[model samples]
Target: AGEAIITPADKKHPPTIPVTGAAVTIGVELGCAATPQSLQINGNLSNAVEGSVTPSIQGTGTVSGNGSGGSTGGQGGGSGSLSITPGLSATAADTVTTGGSLTGDIGPGTTRDFPIATKPLSGRDGYVVARETRVSVDGCLGGAQIRSYATAVISTPLGENSITTYGRTLFIDRDHPGAPPKLKPAK
Candidate 1:
């Protein structure tokens, strides 16, 4: 929500406030359990101003499924966790956290939903806005060769429409049982 007020209630002339378009930043990180249990990471965005920004995910490891985004009003806070349905024989340990709702369907080597806002932000000047992206090991299971990570895109019609980021890498060796799974950040 955005509200405006006269700064200096008693002042004769109110100074003109400088409004800057919001700047969007995307970040990716890996989250791992103690053992070779699961792989996960956090994806976050910092908006320099106030507005509605759409976030989407695309990856090689996961197949794209159909899903709708959440409601479109007010400010959505915090990065929530999403459990992806496994497409392969592997157990369901994979998950992804995108500030926006998951769009694509959930399955091994398949990324989640893509959110496109019908309404653009008002392009008002405000405080710094923070959003999160989380990627878990559950997404890297199943299939002949599991894709390690996915690519993230944050877009806003206000200024820069699209900014791209990537996920970390997971090393899974079926032959070497003793060699536990390893998680590495995107290079």
Candidate 2:
């Protein structure tokens, strides 16, 4: 909210001053983006079980994204924060502004929504699983000219035990390309 004024004021005769000053609002645009991700398997099983499994896992390849952008603006001398200095004779703009959002369903990673692979095991037989994920956000800091708010919710519990007991992995090498052929049995 701003102020209004008049001059030569008496009980019955008051001067009429027109309203004035800069507009009270602004707007901006926003967007989202993503990148490529992949996985490779290596390593051999030691003391192999007397059973076998055939697996067929399909993956979604690399990805990218874009988003819309807008700005919060006012009718002023410059693009700095919006403020006013009250005095006898104040000057400003009467520009009215609206707001907009720059949003995209984008990130550094993508969901492999489709099931990758399945395996059937006999008694005392087990399998392995590996997961790698990265997340980030940009250009959303709160400032005098721009304010930002973000909320993140994770349904997955936090801990090693959050994973299914038997479907978990015993070892893996995310950076390494190949696994050695010989592995001593898991005592």
The TM-score obtained by model 2 is 0.14
- In order, candidate lDDTs are 0.35, 0.29
Candidate 2 local lDDT, residue 31: 23
Please give each candidate's TM-score: 0.20, 0.14
State residue 121's C-alpha deviation in candidate 2, in Å: 2.2
Per-residue CA lDDT of model 1 for 11-124, tens digit only, reads 787535432333333233433222323435545654443334444454344234444456664443344445544342222333444463323333334333422222222353
After the best TM-score superposition of candidate 2, give how far the Cα of residue 101 lies from its true spot, in angstroms.
Answer: 12
Worst 10 residues of 2 by lDDT: 144-153
lDDT of 2 by residue, 1-187 (tens): 1111222348486535422321111111122233323333344433422433454444444444444545864333323243444334333444444445454333252222222223322222234232332223343222111111111111212311111111112222235525544645657
